[model samples]
Structures are given as C-alpha cells and as structure tokens.
Target: MQNSFVKVPLWLFERVVGFLLALPIPIYSSAVYGLVTNMRGLPHMLGMYIRGLYYRQKLGLMEPNVFIDQGVFFAYPQGVELKEFSYIDKNVLVMSKTAKVGRRVHIAPRVFISGGGDFEIENYACIATNSNIITSTEVLKDGARCSGPMVSADQRRVFRGKVLIKKDAFIGANATLLPGVTIETGAVVGAGVTAAKSTEPWGVYVGERAQRVGTRDSVLCPDN
Candidate 1:
C-alpha cells in the first residue's frame, strides 16, 4: 500500500507557496475579467524562471557563462557539458541524453542534435546552419525516390546512416549528412553536399557522392 502521510521537501513546499502568492488578481468587469489577461503572462514567466534559473542552476552540467538563446527548445534527457565560451545559438534544438560540447564550439542557428546515445562536439568544431545530427533512421515519405533510378522496378532503394562531424571539420550550409558517415578531422564539406560515406581526412568533399575535389595542406601528411 502507498504511504498516505508522505512528507514533501521544504524546497518544493516553498515553490508551491511562492507560486500561489504570485497568482494574478482580476481587474476587468467581465466574467473572465483580469483572470484571462493576468494569468496569460504568469505561465510564461514561471516557465522561463524554472528553465532559465531553477533547472539550469540546479543541474550544474553546463557552465555559468553558457548562452542558451531565447525560444530554444530542449527535450527530455537533455545533458549538456559545455566548456568555456561555447554558445548555443537561437532557434536551436539540442535533444540528447548525453551531449558533451567542448570549448569554443560554435553551433549555428536552427541546428538539431538528437540521439539516444552520446552526441559529442570536440573543441573548435563548427556546426553550420540548418544542419541535422541524428543517430536514428527515419522512414522516407511515400513516393519518395532517390536521385538515381532503382535497379529493380518493384523495389525502392533507401539510403540511411549515422552522421559524425569530427574535430576541426566544417559542415557547410544546407548540407544533409546521412547516417553512419564520418566527416574526418580537418575536412571541409562543400555547401549542399550530401555526404553518404566517410570523407577522407583533410580533403575537400563536394558533389552528390562527395568526392574529394581539392586537397588540403594537411592531406600531404604520411597518412594520406
């Protein structure tokens, strides 16, 4: 049987008291009166305070100076370990159970990072605008087809994989990184390139198959 006389924590009791005290008073003469107008801002303000002050401060995972822009949405199991001078830009969606972001990592606007496992961003890694870093595969829409024709008329070919943008790797704007693809360290993926495979480290990748178009100075290393 469940305990009937369960004791509530002091902090929780204090929060309840504070919320009741902050309740708005009706001012208008109508039936709804000030209840509608005043109560509208109450939820928004409380939500902001809880997320911006209470949860963030209590969690202690992110650094003090980390900048979380307005209107940014963080989903469940959100874990962010950001080093100094790292900023999460506006309208970004960072949804991960465990996400480790290194120092000076610049994440551009409207980015989405979601996965059940860990999502890591090494130091000095830059994630460009409208880029998606997802671990799971999403089913394609009906009648959706690949750029090339299928080998069999009755069957449909689907391209799915994991996406990894390594340290010092730059993902250009509007680039779609497929599953199981690793953008090697110091490599530059050209704009609008859909990388379907692991790119050579320190090489410039462009086009549909993301072929190595230009060789960087670092590619001259013995590993190349």
Candidate 2:
C-alpha cells in the first residue's frame, strides 16, 4: 500500500514536468530570458544556451557558436550582429546601432561601446576590460550651442563618426577609442591610452593621447 502511494505522486510529478517541457522554447525564452536578460546566478552552461536562443530568435543577429556571458546588456540589440565564434564577457554593455562584432571577437568585462550605424569590430579583435569605444558624440566645440542628446533635435549638433577595430587589433584595459578612429589590423592600444585618431597597421599605441610607441610583430598575429 505504501509503495502504491509513492508511485502515484511520482507519476503526477513526471506528468507535470512533461507538460512544462512540452511548451515552446519561445514562451520560456521570452517569459524567463526576456525578462531577465542578465540571468545572473544561473548555471553558466544553461545561461549560455538560453541566451543563444534569445539572441537568435528575439534579441538580435547572432551567428552560431557565439558565447555571450551573463550580466551583459545590449541597449540596442536590434541593430547589432554578433558574428561566429565571438565571446562577450560578463557585464559588457553594447549600446551601438548597426554594430558588427566580427568573427572570433572577444570582448572583455565591463567594456562599453556606443555609436551609430557602421560601427564595427573586425575579425580576431580583442577588447580588454573597461574600454570605451565612443563612436558618436555632441559637437561641443567653438562655443557651439548644439550639444548632447538632451537638447532638441534642431539644437543638437551631433559629431557622428565611424569607429572600427580592425582585424587582429587589441585594445587594452581602460583605453578609450574616440570617434572616427580606427585601430588598424594588428595594432595594439596600450592600457589607459586615449586614442584620438586612426592607428597605423601593426602599430602599438600608448600614453595620454595615442602615440605609436612600437610596432606589434605581425608574426604573433599569424591570421591577421
């Protein structure tokens, strides 16, 4: 009699679980993953799987085998395309429009990228922690009245420019790549540097304003 009672509850529990599992992934994806984009504290493997589905179906364009870690936030994911084999570390924020993260790109933790359409990180690029890639900003020069997003459209004079991290480029921690600048293929932006202009291919930049301190040997960047 005791064995029969135990089997009854187990059977009911299995049926309930089966019913839940029968539901579409979209419903679960939206209900849970949509509401909690970060999904922090979830198992790493599970979070990656759920986020992969969410990105492909609802969030934005993500190629196969992309690893998007927890705590990442996309302010404008509709216009972003995450390329194949890319990895985004935790807590990174991408606020760009029409941004393309190229193949095998690895973005480290707490990096912030914001710009308009045409912003891109080319294949094999690595962005270190806390880097800021600001591709567009208000024209706050020569006593101009136009400035910032808060002002009216007519009053706002935007300084829009394209920022690109080319193939095999490496941006160091706390570095800031300014509007309209491109870190060319194999270039390295050193830690704490502020890049104000485009870098030459294979150059290594350092200091307050981008200065080519040396050249990164192309041999190390074999695929570049």
lDDT (CA) per prediction: 0.60, 0.79
List model 1 lDDT by residue over 1-224, tens digit each: 13434445644564674444334435322322222222322225543333333324323366544555444545542365766666666566766556677667788778887654446676667888897776444345676544434334334444444456677788887676665678788888887787777888789988877889897666333421
Query: Could you report the Cα RMSD, in angstroms, for every candidate shown?
Result: 11.7, 8.3
Misplaced by over 4 Å in model 1 are: 1-55, 58-60, 138-162, 218-224
Off by over 4 Å in 2: 1-36, 41-43, 141-143, 220-224
Worst 10 residues of 1 by lDDT: 33-42
Q: How much does candidate 1 score in TM-score? A: 0.59
Q: Which candidate comes out best when scored by TM-score?
A: 2
Candidate 2, residue 6: Cα displacement in angstroms equals: 32
